[model samples]
Target: MKITFTFILLNLCIFISAQNDSINDKVISYDDKIILRLNLDTNVDDYVISSKELNIKPRLELNNQINTSFGLDYKIISATVSFAPHFFPGNNNNLKGKSSFTSYNFRFFPKNIIQTLSYKNSKGYYISNTQDFVSNWQKGKDPYLTFPNLRIQSFGGSTSYIFNKDFSLKAIYYQKEWQKKSSGSFIPSLNYEYLIFSDNQNSVKSREHQLNLSFDAGYYYNYVITKHINIAPFAFAGLGKKWSSYKSDVTKDEREKQNYFTQNFGAGIHLGYNSERLFFGSKFNYSGNHYDDNGSNILQNNFYVLLFFGYRLDPPSKVKKVYEKFQDKIPVL
Candidate 1:
């Protein structure tokens, strides 16, 4: 099933690439250069449960970890691999238990359209508000409630279109292009994901599967301060639907299915500097979503800061030859 889904998604992206239009002259293209980037970002996940009837709110979070990723961009395709290294200071906190995260992401830009696909896996989590549960819990000395066997895996993809030809999202994201002048765009996107949540606790195992779909309307503006510097800000809001199926080893009811409505919103800003061959950037973003789960409100929130430095190099002859060979068959290349 996974293989079939991936194949279909790839074909869909390829079909979308065929509909691409020409970019405006204000956007500088760097299709001939190969860009290598190093990125550092806080990759943390958090969940909050609130119950009005019980008059209590509890929060759960994964260990706060700094993730490092290596990215490569050549022509229309870009890819990144990310992992949480153990050598990072806060990643090894004993109070939060052990946690791990890994992700693989790819983006394809075909003129004015952008398509993205990603897979992420995370394990281990802990209740963050230990003092609320334990009256005498000492800070930094007491352990929080830990879910060492909890795991989450997701497969996701998104497709977006740039309505304004003068604006280049690639300038702010992948650095494959540069916007010569200030411009804004009303970009719209469709996102979909399949997620699995599983845990084994106290000898009882449970699992849940969810499929989600959302549509977002976003606006981004790139303000060119100078020839080598720019600032970009973006905001988006979306509504989604989630279909979930859950099962437990202790339940005789086999599987239970449920549907939920969700809403999400976020805003962010990026500051960047770009030269002939070197580029660096920093970004800060916050996002949150909420849904009703069995009469209780469940909310997920995320905030992260990212820093990246990248350098452009000339592609080798063999690499250029391979890309040229396939450019005719795959228009996205």
Candidate 2:
């Protein structure tokens, strides 16, 4: 009977050991983590992933390819709107919406670089820039401003590089198509700046300019309010000269004044708020008297309710959200 009891005990021990081993072997490995992600018809690329530390032995540094086995398990759909007024101090009406899905699988680890590419096509009633460009209602004579039918088709990419978590340089390149536009080509650009404010250690100030082919020196700051909301406020003022020369028929009887000392000296500020998911954004661009109505000297204010949307087949990484829940434990240096 003692031998029988001993035999039963031995069997029980083996059974328990086997069960534990199986559990370990079957559990998902963090090294097999998905680093890249994509959602159906979504604007922002959410591939901004970080080390999945909670899961044990993150597979951040692996040579595995992206895995697509999960197949459309979840999704997100939403909409948004805004109001920005005539070049400044007031309000303008705006609105928007979309539907999308997200999925992932892989073991790819990258440190501080992220890129997002997307495309979105939306149709709505907008101020006419496709037709008449200059019209403004004034107190007496019309306010001598041009607002054309603004049917714009824009395509662009937003990219970011973090020299470190504290210092990141980001920029956007866009080519727009307006049914009927203005003097400037379809080139509209924005930079995503993340810099240390009041740190005084960076020693790098923000720079900006309207003049082409000339170098101007400047300061910038950026913040992410939430997963889908981001705000970047920057101030820059600089000096430069116009590189392009225009011929004057009135001055020299059609002689071109091709070379002259053209200086643009002014101070300006930029306010940008973006909703990554919906690809919605607002910008307040104000500069101190540097541009004119028709090429004459006059103080001007150029403002817009920047409406843009695009879909990204791939997503980008944003470390802020990924680390938010763990912020208490992280050193904020």
**Model 1 per-residue lDDT tens digits across residues 1-333:** 375367548746565657445656898888789999999999577889998687667888778569999999987778999999978998889988988899999987766788888999999999888788889898799998899999999888888988898899999998988999999999998888888999999989999999887888999999999999999999999999988989999874789999999998889999999988999999999888889988899899989999999999999999999998998786555
**Which 10 consecutive positions of candidate 1 have the poorest summed lDDT?**
11-20
TM-score of every model versus the real structure: 0.95, 0.30
Alpha carbon lDDT at 249, candidate 1: 90
lDDT of 2 at 298: 31
Candidate 2 residue-wise lDDT, 1-333, digit = tens: 243234434433333232111112211212112121221211121111122333221111111112111111111111222112123211122211111122222111123332332222221222212123333533333322211211112222222233323322221111010111111111112221111111011342222112122223334344544444445554444443332233322333343333223223323322323222223344444443243223343332323223333322222245434544454453220
Q: Root-mean-square deviation of each candidate, in angstroms?
A: 1.9, 26.1
Candidate 2's TM-score reads: 0.30
Q: Give me the runs in candidate 2 sitting further than 4 Å from their true place.
A: 1-212, 243-278, 288-301, 314-333
lDDT of each: 0.87, 0.25
